[model samples]
Target: MLCLGAADTGRELCHACHLELPWLGSQCRMCALPLPNDGQLCGQCQTSPPGFVRVVAPFRYAFPLDSLIPAFKYHRQYAFGRLMAELLVEALHDAYRDSPRPECLVPLPLHGRRQARRGFNQATELARPIARALELPLSTGVLRRVKATASQQGLPAAERHRNLQGAFRCVRAAPIEGRHVALVDDVVTTGASIRSATRTLLDAGAGQVSVWCIARTP
Candidate 1:
């Protein structure tokens, strides 16, 4: 679907275009950061691990994904969002084949002002189909972005973490308490946002937290 070319195999994205996608290879076991080898913790994770247990990402943040994510996130391109979600669904199937599934999926919540201005939350849109495909409950009210912080783009990792400090709060503790929850986002760049959200959920009594994103920055 990305190339608008005929798909002989009946897939939305043709084989040629699919081959061009920046698929993630070996990665850190925790944050899914690209690494030379797989199944090992990265230095960052070893020194100061993220609040989440692990991250599941299928693609690197490059090329077609870099372009496609922006269009879907900022240009209101719902078709592109759906396509990415479908790809994530397939990844999640393999990811959870031997692992325990989360009790619920929570999309990274957008601040009220941002959601109002955008008319939709891209993370929620991406998580909806994944939740349906995985047979997991989608929980939107579990977390809320209380502080409307500055854009994280271009900010260093430390600054990004400071920017999102206290930005997220678990409004409904009943559903999250002692249950494994997966946080969903379209893309994960330094993972500061995910860490902050996971911290909030854990503080709210969640037993464990995992991250699910379509792409991770290399």
Candidate 2:
């Protein structure tokens, strides 16, 4: 195994180490719920609203990744962001079959004040490297969070939805018109943020929208 200790900067990992993560297996590739076998969209997504067309994530917000996100977000250790992006790319390649590819990537936005105070949007940080890796167009301004809501950390699942309701807005009426979009975030908890972002994209005329993230909270 390629350990962090054996890496270039003693922090950035070698490619071999990055490839070792336990990627989510046999997910629907649409909603990202693990499949009994493997398929693109499941019966559940076919029956009802998935909010987003698909989701791509490598890790389940468990183990080393869970800790690494906080380390990057709260501690400003930007290296973790790069590692997370690498993992996200792995997931995308593992999941999707074909594409006009996504026309652009939109990181789930944080309200302006919070982003300023934090010195960075963690989602943006995570998305940057992935966009570079994938050579995909990235529109950071495509989605904006108009309202600043309370942290969802300790809130009950039901309350989490309430806290984030109507929190995001599309920059224009039809930003994603007839284009495929991939929405990104660092970690998805309850999928509230992604759902809100996806709704905005669909309303804006996106033909399809997918979610790609470093981790999924489960």
Candidate 3:
């Protein structure tokens, strides 16, 4: 679909195009931030670890992804989103090969007004295919974005964290309590949003939380 050329069998992205994508390399094991060496934690993660146990992202936010992700996210290009989700599913399979799978998948919630304006929550849409492929329940009602704060985009890291304070609340703790949950999103930048969501889940008694995203900003 991207190159107007025939895709590989059972794949949305052709192999040639896929080879050229900016795949992540030498990332921090905990946060998936790009690092000089593999299997090490970033300074931020070592100094103050995030609430989530670990992050799984297959691509770095660069080049075509910088364009493709925004197109899928803001321009209503759902086909592109689906392609990215498929790629994420593949990564999840690999990431979970040795690790325990989460009991449920929770897409980061968008505020009601934002969902109304966008006509859909991008994270929820991205999680649907993953739920089916991974055979995990999609728990949409468990969390809600009660506060509609300013967008985290373009904000400094500190400001981003402040914006997300009190942004999420656990609406249905019964499903989350004592259960391992995978929080799903399209991209992770400053990680302030996911950190807040993770705290909410942990506070609700979730056994553990992991982040799953299509891309991560380097």
Candidate 4:
């Protein structure tokens, strides 16, 4: 396979690995899943309101699309983050046609030790571009993971919420007060982490908190 970076490839991204992924697709607007290329909210979201006001996932976390995520997340290929973020900005435009916009964007924070070892926060890297595109303040430090815990993978989906209980805490409330803040993350496997994050923001007095992830495992 030709490398995406090679001059002869002449491709912005490697088609063999993944195409230019659409961060915003014809998804159930509430869940961010591909619909029949139409509508605002899907049947599921319309029936019941999720804890979050809205969830906007640009892509389904599958196939070759999943590969590049780990490349940037685990190995620090920061450029790929730019692609993910741009797609998310598109998703945001599609999601908020009628609703008022958020005041700021916050990246899902990593615990101190995990970040110290990994040397960076993957979510923060991905959030940077969207924050700039939206002209929204990025306040990651406001919410933090006080505890470093097990990977969400391999856990039962029902137990996911319990596992993440109290995992997040808000250090400062000023940034989010009465603001429609959005949470940025690389993926949403179980929705537990984002729930915890929303809990933190709500506790900190955020008027509204929506989740914007690159991909969702739905």
Candidate 5:
């Protein structure tokens, strides 16, 4: 079904609206933070290396996406979730032609209490379609969020990192050793969460871990 106000006869979004979306142009090679120059690491990444080998975020977390993401995540507007996943797949196909594909896709786990309240793991929902499209295994339980930390939304970078300390653990012996893994999420903010989660995967014997997100905050 077409969404309300969709134009161009039979598209989910009209050409103009699509053009107006906050698509990322140039981004940091390491963290996918929006950058003025392409193929360069951001200052933060240069000073302190991140756990993930690379990050891929096709959209900027701004404008329509900021509104759309909250609606999908907080209000259970699932259509937006599906739309965002499809968009990420399209972007990946174009950007990752020569990049190494991960053997498995891991959705960043949410704590049980948070998952119970939210009724679903948004990251898992986002990764399911991507896994199907890419023909890669989706491991939903291999990585578990053990501690329920305070929300990182308004927290500073230092605080965010501290909040996620000891928050993630590997629950299953899933043969992840020497295998590339892609951690999927809806957005990459300060990247503290990805750092903590990737640390767990790395410590658990993942050969290399990459982050795949729909959007990143510039």
Candidate 6:
């Protein structure tokens, strides 16, 4: 309720703030990129498909979300992370209500050095409560980010893919074999990271992989 930000309001978000958040209205089925229609693939996905079968994101990367996300990730303001996870869970319940839930949740891993610097993997923090609420197993040990790369924020789309090549490895194949897996992350931009991570899961025998993230950049 709006109260999350205001003690007196006690609402998820105040009406004014809620109206200002960039909600993703219609999005591509494959990449969760903003689209003219909700269930259709964007032209780019039609030409060059992503590895993950579907992506579900609730918000657009804009305004206050852009600010709040960094606070959670860089500043360790976990209350923001908890609130984001709660919102993402609510979105998932509605989006996948009729679909088969993934067998387990695999968080997008952070490189050991990066995690040491940041003090936590933001994706793991986001996924833990989601797995608990969904009654799904969380397999953090299944995936590993073996390579560290520069931040992808300003890279060209093609460069982003190159930066993440060989960045991820499937460390535990048995848990995901023949299983539908949901790869969790906090944000998806050009989708290079999720696509690279999903390839590892699929190569290791995952039957299918879907992406779950809080925000997507159009």
Clashing pairs in 3: none
Task: Pick the winner on lDDT between candidates 3 and 5.
Answer: 3
Inter-residue clash pairs, candidate 4: 23-58, 26-35, 27-33
User: Candidate 1 lDDT, tens digit per residue, 98-169?
Assistant: 978999999999999999998899999999989898889999999999999999999998999899989998
Per-residue lDDT over 6-99 for candidate 6, one digit per residue giving the tens place of the 0 to 100 score: 5332435666676667899998888989988878888878998887889889999987789889999999999889878987888899988998
Residue by residue across 126-174, what tens digits does model 3's lDDT show?
Answer: 9999999989999999999999999888999899999999999999998
TM-score for each of the candidates: 0.97, 0.85, 0.97, 0.82, 0.94, 0.93
Q: What overall lDDT goes with each candidate model?
A: 0.92, 0.76, 0.92, 0.77, 0.88, 0.90
Query: Residue 15 error for model 3, in Å?
Result: 0.8
RMSD in Å for all candidates: 1.1, 3.2, 0.9, 3.6, 1.9, 2.0
Once model 6 is optimally superposed onto the true structure by TM-score, how far is the C-alpha of residue 50 displaced, in angstroms?
Answer: 0.9
Q: How close is candidate 1 to the true structure, as a TM-score?
A: 0.97
Q: Could you give candidate 5's per-residue lDDT for residues 15-62 as a string of tens digits? A: 677777899989889999898999999999999999788898889999
Worst 10 residues of 3 by lDDT: 1-10
lDDT of 2 by residue, 94-140 (tens): 56657556878888888899888999998888878888888987788
Candidate 1: residue pairs that collide: 1-12
- Stretches of candidate 1 off by over 4 Å are 8-10
Clashing pairs in 2: 30-54
Model 3 regions lying over 4 Å from their true place: none
Q: Where is model 5 more than 4 Å wrong at Cα?
A: 1-11
Cα misplacement distance, residue 10 of candidate 6 (Å): 7.4
Best-matching candidate per TM-score: 3
Deviation in Å, model 2, residue 123 alpha carbon: 1.2
TM-score of 4: 0.82
Error of 3 at 162 (Å): 1.2
